[model samples]
Every structure is written in C-alpha cells, then in structure tokens.
Target: MKHLTETDLRAWLAVIADPLATPATLLAWLEGPLKKFFPYQAVILGYGELTVGQVKTTHVLASGHDQVFLDYLPTAYETADRSSIKWWRTSRQPFFIDPENPPAYASAFEIDEIQRFGLGNVVAHGVLNIKANAGCYFSFSGVEGPLSDWHLEALKLMTPLLNDLLLAHFYLKSERSPLELDALTAQQRSIVRHLAAGMDDKTIGRTLNIAEKTVRNQLGKIYAQLGVHKRSKLIALLK
Candidate 1:
C-alpha cells in the first residue's frame, strides 16, 4: 500500500462530518476517492446489530447484483458460526474469504453462497457498537487481486466513518424513510415482504395462492400507494 495522499486523507475524514450525508453520497465516496486506496469491484454493507439477523434492517450495496443474490446476502452474512463479522470481533483482525481457497473459518455453505453470487475474494471489517456487538459491517468483494496487509490496515482508517455514513442513512431502508406501511392491506403487506425477499410475481402468486394476473394487479396498486414505480425501488424501500 502507498501513503495516503493529503487529498485522500481529507476526502476520507470530510465525509464523517457531512451534515447532509446519505447513502448515495456515501456510494459516491466509496466508488470515487475511497477506491484509490481501498480497491474493490463490488461491496456489500449491513446496517444493524450483531448476534441477530433480520432482513428489514439489512442494507446491501453491490454492483450488478441480481434479486436473488440481494436476498441471499444478509442471511449469508449473519451466519453466526462463520461470518466475517463474528470472526473479526472475536479475533480483532480483518477477515478474508477466498472462494477457491477457503479459509479455516469459512464455512462450506458460506463459500457456496459467495460463489453462487459470483463474488470472489471477499474481505470484511466492521465498526461494532457500544458492547462490540454491531453497528455496521462491510464486505468488499471481487477485489482486483490479493488483498494486502496494508489494505487491511487501511480499513482501520475508514470503517468507522463508513459505518457512520451507513447508520445515518444508507438508502431507502434507512430509519429516516417515511414508509406508509400502514397504508397497505394485509395481503399487500405480504406481497411486499415477498418482493423484498426477492420473489418474482409468479412466485409471490404461488406463495399467496393468487393468480399471477392478480399479483400483477395488486402490485400496481401497491406501487401507487407506496409511490414506487418498479420492483427494484419497492425492494429498496422495504429490504
């Protein structure tokens, strides 16, 4: 790793104090100035506590991710026995997962999940909460090549600020979003959950025991009520 330029250091610290920070802003920073030092082709972020898993509180950001992979990410990350978050907290070091050469801590299921998503060479670190449970965590996938010792060291500089940006407001799922979930009917709510879980209309229809046409029609109504025009936007809000 090279020395952090004055520009890079400034860019890194400047974001934590950004009063108008949002996930879009954070993504810009990550894909922009931050990438110069900490390189990754794709990244996933989780905003919540440790020792517990819930899709509602998870926020994942990955490039070119399909719906099924997005739905799988949070569950795979929260694997208590083998997650990088659990490994890092317990070992006080950054954790690494390589698909072809799995680490001792990497579970078979975890590796399979990563491979299934087509993400290679995962490296993870986090900014834990008061009790060192969890505040936010991140995994940088498809790293250009080997992640060096210096790369892990670089994470020490950035994780907290990234966590700050994440917890403050990462995206639609942010606590700040004014979701009118109460506006939904019970069936609509179920559909929304299924959608967030990466179910397509046909699958949702099967699950709800409704015709595919009805699922599409109800989705139209749900979209109108929620002010989202597409499945991706709707999932972003609820996932």
Candidate 2:
C-alpha cells in the first residue's frame, strides 16, 4: 500500500473518533494505519505499570506474526528506552528511537536487544502521560532505515487521540483508583498541566506570560508540594 497523505491520514483518524470505540476496533484500525504509513513485518502495542523501582507489563497487542519478540523483554529492560514503553508514561519529552541515533545512555547490549526484537529499524514516539501512570507509544518501522518526516507526521497527527485512548485504557483497567493530589495551588496546577503536556519552562512561562525564573520558582514549589525531587518524578505524580 502507498503511504498516507495528510488528507488520508486525517480521514482515517476521523473514522475512529468515537469515544466508545472498542479496544479491538481501535487496534484493528491502528494496525492498518501503521502498515499503510510505514513498512514493517509486524507491529505490537505493549502496556505496563510502573512502581518506584519496578515496571510490570500488563498487556500486549501484536499482529499475528510478531508474538515471538516478547521473549526478549525482562525486568532488566526497565532502564529507559527498553522498558516496554512505560517510560513514556512519565516523561514530559517525547522519547524517540532512531537506531542510527540511539541516545548516549543506551548500551551496546541494549541496542543489540532492540535489533534482536525486530525493533532496530523502528522509530517509536510517546504520546502523553495518562491515568494509572500510563502513556501511549506510536512506533513505525521499516525494513532497513529510520522513518521519514512523512511517516513521523502521519503518526504525530494521531497523538491527541492516542493520549485520550491511553487514559481510557487505564481508567478501565486500574483497580486501586489513582490517588488524587491535594497539594497543588491553582497556579501550580496550571504549571503542572503545561509541563505535563511536554512544554519546557520557557515555553510554559511564555504561554502563562510569566518570567522563566518565575516558572522555575513555581516548579520548585510544585516539586516540594508533591514530594518529588525531579521533573520525572513530578510527571509520574501528575499521571
């Protein structure tokens, strides 16, 4: 199949816009959309939960041919990029895997695992942090190279919808009912919201029309209020 045009992508997304669309339908639509946008032998969507020092995989969706790849996932995969996509749930920035430009923190063996899992030529993108400490991952793969801009944009266009779906997924599966935070002030809530949406301090400040230093000060207060020491922790809290 040919790659999707912007118009075609928009239409495809619109067809699945029903808020109550079943999970099976969502997965079915996504499989066709992903294959149309990028070349890959198979695709899978994995889900998990994160504790302070542990990550637990709860669910996984794979096209029929790709089930064997899950054998490579283990607790050691919790480092960052390999963590069954749970890292993206708490990250404010988009995590990308280009294979050609793997991040510096990635090790030789980690890279090997990616290749072995049939993910070496894949470019994965994270959507947003949602209920029950979950996020959605959009991954595109090819036979021998990284994704092109067209491919990225096609997936990017689905991010907003993807974020909503993740929240719904968590809300359906979670049992303990997420803890509601009472420490945030109104301004702090606004700040946290912007930060959670992947805005930097400067961007948050500009959007809120405050000084960047003021944004930092607010973030410091927020961190203290939420009992977090860093942005990552703060993100996890917000989720």
Candidate 3:
C-alpha cells in the first residue's frame, strides 16, 4: 500500500466530516476515492437492527458486487457467518479473512460456501449502537494481498464517521411513528417503552410489578402487533 499523502488525508477528513452525508455518499467515497489507494473489487455495507445471538433485519446499504452475491447475504450468507456473530457479541475490532487464513469461527461447510464466491480477501468491521439495539457491518473484499498497516489506519479513520452515519439513519427511521403502535394496548405500550429504554424483560417485569413470564407473553403480543420478530426490531419500531 502507498503512504497516504497530506492531500489525500485532508480529502478523507472532509468527506467524513460532512454532517449531512448519507450512507450512500460515504460508501461512494469508499468505493471511488479510497479505492485508488487500497483497491478492492467489492464493498458491502450491511445495516439494520441486530439482536444478541441473531441478526434481525439486514439492509444492504451499499454493494459494488454482483446482485446474486448481494441477494445471498441476508439469508444463506448471514446464517453461516459465525465470525460476524462472534464479533457482534464479543469484539468491536475489525477482522480480516483471506484464502490463506479463513475465519476460524466459520464451519468447514460455511467456509466452502464462502470460497465459492471467489472473494479472495475480506476485512470486516462491526458497528454497533447498543442504545438503539441497532448495528452494521462494513466489509471490503476481493483484494489481492494482505491489508497493509496504512490500509488498517485508513479504516480506523473512517470507522467513527461510518458509525455516526448509521446511527443517524436509525434515529431518522425511529422519528417516524409507525401505525402498528396503535394496535398495542396500554400495558403493551408500556412494555414497548421499556424495551426502547434498553431494559431487559426481567427488569421491565420488576418495574411493571408483573411476573417475568407475563412480560414475555405481553412482548410476544406486542411483536405480533408490530409485525416484528425480535426485541431489536421492536425497539427500532417503537423507540
């Protein structure tokens, strides 16, 4: 990798510092300008509500790859991506995988499936906002060689702004009132509020003077009413 020039550094800073930049715009910068320095065949930015132990909703914010590859991500790819799951649960650091060093967290079957895509090398970062129960994954793939120190440094510089943009998108979505909330009863609404506040079911139950099972049952109904399947989605919907 080439050393980053002062002009290049300033340009990067300018793009990320733009408060009004959208996810698409930031990704465009990555795919275009940034690529000149650290070339990659494809980049994928996945964002949406995520729950511990599972991925609830996955939106491909950006992709410079084949549609078939993009389509597979939400279902087959995600189901088999143990490294991402582990990263979400245990670590915030960026991780890399390549033909030489496949992800240990993945099963042999999973590795085989991924290898079929021919994405040579990959570096992924998990962006999380615990308060909103939302997170994202930014992945750069299809490079020829191992990522250099400068490449890692560039990624570190971009992380905060990417995270802020994702969280902003979440907040914007949350500002709109979903009509589904009207279907919830008073007690159910209370549970939804507690969920948004990042309280666990047990804590909510204690606060509401209800049994834990009752809280769970109420949450189930709330989920049905809101057409959501996980606590994270529920929080996203009502938060």
Candidate 4:
C-alpha cells in the first residue's frame, strides 16, 4: 500500500477550499496543487438533478477535454424513452477504472461514457443528495497508474470541497436564453426547428436539401450556441 503524506492532503484541501476559487481558476488548481498527489490529464465535473425517468445535468465543466467530448456527453447515454440509467445515479464510493479491465458490474451507460470519451485510466467519485435526488460527479481520466486505496482516499477527502465548488460554477440555465441563440443564422434556426420536431438527420437533410453530415454538424453548433447538451432539453429551451 502506498502511503499518503499528510502534507499533500493539507495542501490540496487548502487550494481547493480557497474562498477566492472560481470556475475560471479550477483548471490551474487541478493542474497545480491537486496534481501534487493526484495526477490526471483531464477532469469532468457534472452536477445533475434527477427526475422520475431521467437525470439531467444542471451544470457541467470539462478541463483538458475536447469540444466534441463536451458537446456529446449529455446525449451519449440517452435512451429512446429516456428511461432510468443506472450510471446516472450516484455512487458515494470512488471508482478506479482501467480500460484494459474496467470495474465490475459497471452499467452499460457508464461503459459507454468511458468508451465514448476515449478515456484512459480513470478514478471517478461523487457525492449525492438523496432528498433532492441530485449529485456532483467527478471523472478524472488519463491517470497514469494502477488504482490504489490512496487515490480513492484522496478523492473521498476532497468530495465535499469539490461539490461546493461545482455549485459555485455557472449553472445550466433552465429558463434563460443561451449565449448566442438570438444571433443564429437563418440556416441554423431551420436546423434547430427540424431537430426539435423530432426529425432525424437524414430526414432533416432531405427537407433542407443538405448533406446528412452537414445537418448533424450544424446541430452540434446549435447545441453549443444554445448552451444545451441534450436534444430534448434544447427543444424545451426553445419553447
């Protein structure tokens, strides 16, 4: 068993728990003080509010991850009916995952997330609020070593501080207009209307007389501009 230095823990907590810390400073903190003990190439933080049949992100941030990874995450696990996906539920314990051999009994959605992200070695942890049926999830990928009790312990120790920091970040606005929706070109708006109407990419392309791939690509831009991660959510936002 690798031993953890108390000094490492103390400094990590001190940096993350700083009152001055904000979303803008999170990447530096993660790559700085936190890396002293926990090393990773990318980290994703998501706060979700669960409903009867689905879990939706209320806020999300990805540091050192790609734009495609961020834009596709919300719908990666989505089902036709949006049924309950086990991975969406919280796990109080940390997960030590290696793509060569993943954690046991990992849900399909969880596995899909790993595969979709092209994640390397990962240690994931989260804190759940039972009453509200919401939680904060942390996924630290591109880890370089085997899973250890030390990594789990470090993440568990930092869970509360991380949760609070997530709450402090820019929340997914359920009621507000996204960053640049009003500025969308007419072509973009047409794509959005077709998407929101439940039309598939091929169908939308035929209607708009564009390539199917172009339709998909334009929808991606609409999602980013509207600040929505899921198609259903985007439709609701536009309504």
Best by TM-score: 4
What TM-scores do the predictions have? 0.59, 0.50, 0.58, 0.61
Candidate with the larger lDDT of 3 and 4 = 4
lDDT of 3: 0.69
Better of 1 and 3 by TM-score: 1
Worst 10 residues of 4 by lDDT: 76-85
Instruction: Kindly list the per-residue Cα lDDT of model 4 for residues 56-96, writing each as its tens digit.
Output: 78667778888888777663233333212344343446777
lDDT of 3 by residue, 1-239 (tens): 66567986987767655554674356566666567655778887667665554566655565568787766765323433565456534766676676567666645654564587877677767677779866777777886475665566667677776677765665665564457777778999898888888999999999999999999999888777767898887676664
Per-candidate Cα lDDT values, in order, are 0.71, 0.60, 0.69, 0.72
Going through the candidates in the order shown, the clash numbers are 0, 0, 0, 0
Candidate that would win on lDDT: 4
List candidate 3 stretches off by more than 4 Å.
Answer: 1-11, 14-24, 75-81, 106-110, 167-239
What's the candidate order when arranged by decreasing TM-score? 4, 1, 3, 2
Clashing pairs in 1: none
How many angstroms is residue 16 displaced in model 1 relative to the true structure, after the best TM-score fit? 8.1
Q: For candidate 2, what is the lDDT?
A: 0.60
Q: lDDT-based ranking, best first?
A: 4, 1, 3, 2
Would you give me the overall lDDT of model 4? 0.72
List ranges where model 1 is wrong by over 4 Å.
Answer: 1-24, 51-57, 74-78, 81-83, 130-132, 170-239
